[model samples]
Target: MTRSVYVTGIGRGDGRQVIELGVMELLTRHVDRVGVFRPLVHDDGPDRLFDLLRSRYRLTQPADSVYGMGYEAAGTLQAERGTDELVSHLVDRFHAVAREYDYVLVLGTDYADTNLPDELSLNARLANEFGASVLPVVAGRDQESESVRAEARNAYRAFDSMGCDVVAMVVNRVAPADREAVVERLAAHLPVPCYALPEDSSLSAPTVSQIVHTLGGEVLLGDDSGLARDARDFVFGGAMLPTFLKALTDGCLVVAPGDRADLIIGALAAHSAGAPPIAGVLLTLGERPGPDIMALAARLAPGTPVISVPGGSFPTAGELFAIEGKMSAASPRKAETALGLFERHVDTVELTKRISVLKSDRVTPMMFEHELIERSRSGRRRVVLPEGSEERVLRAADVLLRRDVCDLTLLGEEEAIRKRASDLSIDLGDAQIIDPQTAPVRERFAERYAELRAHKGVTQELAYDVVADVSYFGTLMVQEGLADGMVSGAVHSTAATIRPAFEVIKTKPDAQIVSSVFFMCLADRVLVYGDCAVNPDPNAEQLADIAIQSAATAAQFGVEPRIAMLSYSTGTSGSGADVDKVRKATELVRERRPDLLVEGPIQYDAAVDASVARTKLPESEVAGRATVLVFPDLNTGNNTYKAVQRSAGAVAVGPVLQGLRKPVNDLSRGALVQDIVNTVAITAIQAQGGTAQDAPSGR
Candidate 1:
């Protein structure tokens, strides 16, 4: 049977979409296939909530399968044919979606300008008829704590009294100051779990693209990517250019008459110089700059959007106030913010317990990627990027900041980094920017480096020289507790990045040698390939340590560890130095960690193919289900990782340096923006003691 959850609200302005998105996120995390159904939508033009859920979660269900009836049609049917006919129609439509998916996320009615009577009771009836549990979200904005608590309890009772199973109550848009009191009061009154979500302006703020669409403005400048940037506030440009620039705020949309070339050029110039990135230039009165000015403005802020609106500034301001932000496919940052807020406040354990959502058996690639980011945000750790001036690293920083995933410090020349960010239209947003040569802690880092390398005969002057390098400086920041971890090598070699950690940060007490792994995210699952980027050739003992470290890394990232020590032969069918090395390593791993499931001298086919494993090593516990693949040499590991990455279209997320005292990871010099983001997330998770965590015991 398909499980269903109906996220409904009592009145408008309840921000129930956040609850819907949150519930969908929870559902996706629990089950592999989840569908969405909105009982009644207001219009045919694309349901905002459904579009967002579909795009964000990669849902396969068609949009037509989601909606039961249009609002006007539903009202007419209820008035003409009575409520029973309307309810029956909706239930049938709901069942159509329910049968196809493992779980159906039923979005209840928004108590907007509907003609229906007793909106709350109607929602309850629909949820009950659909055999769905109710999760009510009450709008607590501007309400007192007592009132918020009262409304929550009343809503719960309303559904419970109707024989509907009320799974949970969410108090959305509660004032930040009143969250504690409201939650506490509700805890003493409500029969179910209550999650209080405080107001977050970022999630509710309109983006540059939304403003342009709402006003029917023409894009005179900027690319689609830059237009997706959020417009958090509106800055009216009425004064002189100098005065107007001072009124600027981060993510503010500049509203000014288009004829004012001074303001337009100045705003673009300020954005390019990285004072604060304006969301976009909203030119009013349908006035536009000359061709020469537009050309110059485009050059000034290459991708900064410049929009021309028909109305004057005053009417535009009114429209802006009336415009509300919705979580759509374009505005994904707000989605991340909403998910973060929901994850932080909700007791998902309790909510899932009531809903009976099952954990997925197969870990999809998307799920693996999502888990990396979710776990990184669960316990955010500070990670420093030494290649701050590198465009890819800066772009990744922009993504990390937008997601609120981790605290980041970018190490380099501040001016150069800012200029590069401006050129790329990237927003660093309070991410610490440090110049290794001139940082206040330079001398302290130098002294520490000198002491650590004293046996290597390093002097203070020499230490200062080494500390001037950004990679070493970043590693020192991690060592001195300035940052939790460091991710570099976007521009430098891997050796240049990790050599500093080897010299200063060093290895853990228990680690015999340093190794690295690439999280090979294939079509269906994530596998760990060890010593792929480090340790050219490891002896038996080092290979064993690598296996242990790789298994721990796999477990920490939520993949259950099943070790398969790879060789050219399966189960001693052949013997050589390489096979013998892997065989000894497998025995060592079993002896050292008796609880670990390990198989030795396994060929690639038997290690991953079930039928081949049955013919070759069916009795082995780790064969055909191994999550961690340990290689005896870097030559094989690196070649295999690259081959899989290129030919199979796999996402290789690492070269995650393991066994470091503190987390210091290296990135590919040709790394994409997303690759940097993933590596940074891995480093942050590592800094949070992710490696020490044990995965769930069973699949």
Candidate 2:
């Protein structure tokens, strides 16, 4: 339940400040309480930045020193600062933080040498210590490594050997042309996500002065020195009013007048210093700070910026917010403005796309994409669906019918449709409801049922029985060429949905296999995980085939398929029949299809680790990373994908039928009405023929 990521680096540099900015921006769209931990901070008299964090955030435990940790073993020069010593110390710090927080972010000290072995050993130690996965980034405020590729690969190997699931490499300050080379280098060796960051000096330095100055505030303390300023996500805070609601926008915001709020927000935000970014927006008293007010700030900002507290007091009119933080009166304008700002940009649409991933029990529909709803002028794939069942199902059908995404044909009794709609309080005139109980389909179903069952399993009892289930009858409509695609998994199992398709529509030629892809989505990316729920345990050839089909499906979803044959071992690291299966499967893929970018015998991280690609098997096309992972077996594939789905708080979209001539989707047995509608949309889109879309920018 406590899923944490270890964000380690060196000193305060290693491009950490920039990396932290990216992490912080990423967190805003996803987590809530991201914590940071620096196990080793050199004891150089007073750390002004850390101290200011304490005062401004009002943290109970100053991040400076969580406990009475003395100055005895602080820097790398200390005898106990060796890798093992450092890892042990790091592990201990993680454990301590893990107890109180759901997830603890472990930051590495810049004091350690940026050597591959040491960095990996350090991560392995911490992963075991905190029971976490490693998302390693190559940190350093240095030029591109002309040849540090080998070292990066070495680090990945260590991380892989230690069983870290996912790994990432951030090539800091990389040139544009070098981007391809770097990507190829890493892709050859590792199987992971490798991002080559361009040199944007803009995000490197974050000065508190800039923040304060931007808001016309002042630097309260630590005015000079290595204080960071480039924030990925920003928050605006005010003690008086109109501030707390701004948090709804881009970053997390706090509404407090003074140090109390500052402390709570600061400590919580900075917990994942290297993992994700968090900040507080401070609103001072009465706008203009008198002498005393000015002095109070000199202690808070340090090198960070401080904004001037608001100055004017406007009149309150109506019911915007009847109360503030302490239940004070709020002006209608001020309160409404703040809330409006949040709603406009805080990403409700993206949230809608990944509802399953968030795993929250509550949700408000935030449909913002026109593409999901709009039909092409020429590509209207009209679908006929039944109407009148449950409130949720009816409402869902209406959404599609109204949106023109599908031409729903609702089948039911005429009076029953109206009565059911009245009971559910939904309008049904917009959708077509054919009364199968009294109309043509009822007669057609009886005729067809008798025609098919007449051969052997003949009986009037069987004919009536078969014609009764609406789903079965609906599939027959499609089989009889009455409809293009049928969506029938609202209150049924995968078998129920597929059996009809298999019996009626049947398989397409060249489509030798039948499997599925569950679209795994997070904030910034969408991954197509195949054969997860479908093929229980496929052979090597089947896996290779699955990889190929999944790749094609991913392309349809607008993903460039860099396929990785996912295995327990990366290359020849481990020996077993399972690993070889992946290896052979990967080979078969290359032999059969040479146009694609594919590789195998790779671990999860290697398929994703760009840095890992830079070294191990660096010349191989798919060692370090593969975005589309071809799992060696269902045991590892199903469980690993699901674990990532649940553990990382990701959404799993479907066991979308692949390698089939037609689009037939399976739904969760206990799916909601919206689930039924969405499944229909997915199937319709595939049938209608649109380019596969890129992952929705994860929320």
**Per-residue alpha-carbon lDDT of candidate 1 for residues 1-25, written as tens digits (9 for 90 to 100):** 9999988898999988888887787
Give candidate 1 regions above 4 Å deviation: 378-380, 389-391, 398-404, 414-430, 454-457, 522-525, 587-595, 642-651, 670-674, 690-699
Candidate 2 ranges with C-alpha deviation above 4 Å: 1-371, 374-378, 384-388, 411-417, 435-439, 442-464, 623-625, 693-699
Q: After superposition, how far is residue 301 of candidate 1 from its true place, in Å?
A: 2.9
1-699 per-residue lDDT for model 2 (tens digits):
555655554232344433433342233224333455655554544443334323422334546434213334533423445656655665676566656643344554454333334434554666666666565555423545545355557657767777765546555545545656776787677776555544433233233333444444433333232122223233434342323333423222222344444433342333223112233334454233356544544443323233434432121101112211110011111112222222222233332232212322211121112223332212556454543464556666655543345666665565555544432223343566665555556566666767765766556666666666666666776666566566655666778778766655666675567877776754345666777877778888888889888888777655678888887677788788888788888888898889988877877777767787666668876665465877766677678777987788765667678766666677666667656666677667667765644322212
Considering every candidate listed, which one attains the maximal lDDT?
1
Q: How close is candidate 2 to the true structure, as a TM-score?
A: 0.45
lDDT of 1 at 55: 81
Q: Could you tell me which 10 consecutive residues in candidate 1 have the lowest summed lDDT?
A: 690-699
